[model samples]
Target: MQPLVVLISTFTLIFVASYASLQPAETYWNSVLPNTPMPKTIQDRLMSGSVHDWGVSKIHPDICAFYIFFPLCIGSNIKAKDDPRRYIFLTESDLKLGTKKNLYLMKSSNNANFLPQKVDDLDASTSKNLTVAINLLLSHPTSAEAKDMRNTIDMCEAGEDNACATTLEAMLDFTTSRLGNNIDTLISEGDTEVKIQSYSISDLKIMKSKKSIVCHKLTYPYAVYKCHSMSDTRAYKVSMVNANGKKINVGVVCHIDTSRWSPKHLAFEVLNVKPGTIPVCHLVPGDSIAWVPNEL
Candidate 1:
């Protein structure tokens, strides 16, 4: 009986080893290989950074505990209110009701001076549709402009992840945009070092009118307080994973007015994140508060 058991175990071991040995190197490596290289146009924009002179020099530490993200005011060209650049952040409605000629995606800058002093340029002429625009960006990534953008993003990535204002912004832009744009392909980009996972707002109840949401502003003031909660809010969950695979779950709420917008739901104000458990942002009691979109 003992000899029979030993023979059976030996056979099992041999079978396992044989199967593994027969596996093709490409097939084995493919499981761990990064997603196919992204097109250049999209890569360029993803690497792009905006020069943020407003609050680049400094940041607060207390707010680093919460996972809240405030809506940022952004435009292609900073036109005066009389010319208001049409809008700040791009929305789906803009695609149907407007065009990308005047739209500019918002990004943050972090200069190692503990401030962000440079901006990365983007060529918006890639495509008209958002999905196609992303694909086109992925396709053509070989120009000097693309190089410059990569330089900026790479600099920040190498810098302190949370300390540099631009690095933080760069992280936010890449995470949010990619997560929002394409989840499966989001983490496939080889350049970024952070790992992430997300939960959509489809089944989650993320909005409330009477509640006062909490957050920490990023710029000079680094305002920490409870923000006014609007009646209409669209949000989802994002898990910023670390090298060890631990997740920091964050509750992000966006103020999107779809009633009178270009797309069914256009996000003028991108999001108001709750400081649930993000390493960068923290929640604290406060006397000062502001409406993020209004601030934008």
Candidate 2:
């Protein structure tokens, strides 16, 4: 009994020491946090949870990757007034054209980094606070404690830059908590080996349904995402063939519940509908991620 008690004490001390010593890599902030300040107009809209006129060019590799994987997503070049899919559209293109190789290049470069890193295994390129927060959130805080954490996250989302890291971590934790011990981060890459294991492009329409978090890459220095999950969300895995004949399996999340979404969301403007009137679906872009529960 004395030995067991000593072991427990040692473990607690080690955990506390490690937790207190955690720090982000010197370059983590430079790579993940935004360098140039976001335009006040765009920032204001984001704070209010409205993505209307995001203004950031989708041609940027990170943003462009979404179009490559989720070709159904309305392109930045398309005017909101011209979009025809104002409601839910589940159609998957068998042959995706017009996507550039630069989008693929960006995904290949950053795919590994987009994954959630463990607190003890983190490197200089990852956000330490975010890692720690996820670990804590997953540890089963009281309901009031969780609510307070979410409030802090809301403050962060409302432009409190100091709280952004914590906000992201908490969001990730909540998103992932939907699953048990079965989370997997999927990044689409066009490779022969992957193609062999992927679904035929035609089979995309019939794939089994699942739940997942479609994490969109937000404009940040290293890597930050607006990761969210909805009850009515359906994420599907489907194969897509690009113009170059490269095949890859990608995740597409369709949100059937937009009732709580801000009416001014970009989807509403692009789809020409008011919030909650109908479902909105989009692809899981190459630069982004789909966190799903792995099927046993």
Candidate 3:
């Protein structure tokens, strides 16, 4: 009887080892292959850091076009009231609506900057920060919300999109909130209440003198964004007035340098101008954020 048990255990061990060996070397991490195939147009925009739409179809068509060709429209002196292009940007209400509908897709824009890292590969400081941020947002590190966020992030990192489909809001909120907290911490210490400033698209005004971080709301199953500071860029506060007359303040950023951008880029095509000839700008959708110095 003892010999039979030993033989069975040996066979189980061999089977497990063989199965693991057959898997890809990157099986241990989310998004094992970083260089996945993407559309040339998207790839070009990403490379130039001038992407307007991160494949989010939920946004309005007119608004999307405006974002794609903002450089042309803004330069043309087109008045928001006279211009046929209705700038109907998303609002807080729209964000909460249908939160459960598109989550099944579980697709990300696949931006390299927002990709999840393997737990083991994350530095000690980063891991600690993530844990602290999650706790801050969810109130308890071991709470159900925190657990869900951690799982969603892990799944997204592991390229298990299908498995991450259900908790789209949690994933989106966690990333944005964590980033917001980081922004607050960056600006001041000791639990400073971060006051985010917003502007509207209808009344676009640029702050040329101030440096700021623009967080653009990305199109995904849920809210996600690619926020960063751009050199040679200007920030604007655009007043976004929806059809219902509800006002939302939005952030807009214009890139001043396009000398190295691809000539075939959409901005050049839309504006009928050559690359490096003009500045390109786009609005920061609702639920997104931007950080500027408090003095401004």
Candidate 4:
């Protein structure tokens, strides 16, 4: 009887161990891993939820190589170097092109930097069509339609509402003529400039004063140091201090425009300065430079 009881216990243990071993292990998701290079399709679905789907799935392998892989290969990469803003922009560009999987990868990565607000800006129902357009723009940045779209953004930034509106109308007209349907207009007149109020950074209290913060002139997109308001610590306004104790006035901090394919700091071009004199300006606060809640 004792021998039989021992035999039964042994069998039960074996069965339980075997069943546990057969179960799948928890999947670990890493967004930066480089594997599974195939473009999105039905067959590629098998590679889903794998660690190897990171760098391999990017639309622009060349850009990804430069921005993501090269640094790691050479061992000169900055730790946690992924820029959420760039990723969001590039991902949106991909979604605009019809790369559904790329968008899904981004959404699934659960990166804090991913901008859901920007994604929500698109029409939810027409995701596939929007992705198609985005893909086209990504492949051919110099395309006439892409150029027009860029110009429209620029015009809107320059306060040319009529011109911007006309360009948007043209885009809608072109899409309607070609596809026999109109796309949800992502860019409109009212969505242009969003003003953020002044706020505190660390221990420093900022207040929006009489001075309007002006965007520094740069060859690429950069952040402008707008003054923060003291009262609420959330209000920000654009301003600039000039030489000869004169305050040079520029318009409100409307839009952040970038000409480069990557992130950079905002810089100023000093005019009317003495040959040996250097003008001084406040650098963007560390907290300010980092991601802030997109209330604006």
Candidate 5:
């Protein structure tokens, strides 16, 4: 009994001295950076209840390995010493050819001192297709399309400087084209469902967690699209787990277009997807569960 009590006390002490003691992400930026200001957009991302561990590193003088919470997550990743940050702020305009990283807003007032680095594309097809799609939208688009494009570009600027979130906005139409209104129907069109490794959307596995956040960003595809001007999206509270196997609650948010339900008009139509059966893109509804534990 005595030993058990001591063990519990020690664990609590360690947690309080470590995770709880760390200040809000913005504090680190202010202490280490000159004239660091908090943009409302960045704050909105953080306040969404997702804080990613960006881990610490001495990669660059102007940069320490940190994160933008989940979207605007901040923190010193304490995992590997001197681990380099290979994070890329993915968005629609970032579809330029041949780059390790894609960034629309390279620097901003709030994160001026916290320089972000570049990394490789997640997939050539995704980037190339998205790039072509964005260009197409630029050519004589509808009033809404034009507004959407302008907003995405300006997302890099302050007040609403959240290029990552805007990236989702940019890709909203594309993902919708692929998934359409009934995601289950599209995924079931062929053996494509097997490739996804789960029949039920609930069974999908997560990224090979370098570490886990009890509740991670509802970073499902097309999820960011909900943040767009044309689409309707809202906040929903959810739970997730971290690398430590602890439970974490998070909010998943993204969509800007209305025909988000039509497959022909979603990602499929935007990417000009040809075919008999194309791969089913991830489509989490604005108010639905995007990701959850395998047990649930």
Candidate 6:
């Protein structure tokens, strides 16, 4: 009996440990992937830098140092607001280009007495521009403009001007509105159409004296509540009621069906409205209704 007791205790500890370690999986199946929009300002900055040869300095001492250190300094400051998950670090190519531009400015200055002063000024300006470009690119890495820039860079490296020109023209059309009015068009072209799930609410009950009611105990994957209308289906909004019958705005999450007219009840998990309070069910005039237990 003592050995059996010890065995049961060991099993209980294992069960508890496993249950405690369990975590909910990411809800990726229902999540929407964000769309990338072209950043005009960043593209313009890149174009300006390329045309003026802003950072074209010697490879060994000037350009290499600037490229290696400057981006690390500036990249640390860049951040995204809406989705922090979207931020990306600078690529090796981007770093190389930035370094080359800075080195060019350092080498081309003629004022020997003011060389340090001039370099400092140039560094400040370049830092600001770098920050803006990096932030915008990271924020919209998959944008049409970014893609075009990538392709153009590739073509130039491969010594194929004709192919680059063709790609650039398509990019020009995207910028000039030939592609469509908004970024949504570009996103839609690449993404699957998202379908909205709808549900019907059939039976509802409000307890006049109780503060809380159980709506439905669901083991289903997902649920939504909607009301039946002859003209069109409408979603039912839940509202809280004060003792004086005045409605108070509150957010409620529950699932119910309203399509059928019957006395059968749907059970919901326990909801805390308020202790000793009554619930009032508000529906269309012809809606079927039933009472829900406080505990499911």
Best by TM-score: 2
Model 1 weakest lDDT span, ten residues long: 1-10
All models: lDDT? 0.25, 0.39, 0.33, 0.21, 0.24, 0.20
Stretches off by above 4 angstroms in model 6 are: 1-14, 18-20, 25-215, 218-232, 241-296
In the order shown, the candidates' Cα RMSDs to the true structure are: 22.6, 16.0, 19.8, 25.1, 21.9, 31.2
lDDT of 6 by residue, 260-288 (tens): 42222211111212222322122211101
- Alpha carbon lDDT at 23, candidate 2: 38
Stretches of model 5 off by over 4 angstroms after superposition:
1-155, 158-195, 201-230, 233-266, 269-296
lDDT-superior candidate, 2 or 6: 2
lDDT of 2 by residue, 1-296 (tens): 00000111122333333221343332232243223222221122221111122221111232233422233332246544433222223323322333222112123223212212223123222222433443333344344334433433343354211112212333345544565434555444434332122233533432233566555544321234555553566566556655556665555666767788776565666556777776676545544556666552
Q: Pairing residues by index, what is the TM-score of model 4?
A: 0.17
- Give the alpha carbon lDDT tens digit for every residue of 207-263 in model 4: 322222211111111101111111111222223322223222111121222223122
Clashes (candidate 6): 28
Candidate 5 per-residue lDDT, tens place, 213-276, comes to: 1111222111122221111322222233223333323232222232434543323343444333
Off by over 4 Å in 2: 1-176, 186-200, 205-211, 260-278
lDDT of 4 at 21: 32
| Predicted structure 3: lDDT | 0.33
lDDT of 4: 0.21
What is the TM-score of each predicted model, taking all chains together?
0.22, 0.42, 0.33, 0.17, 0.19, 0.15
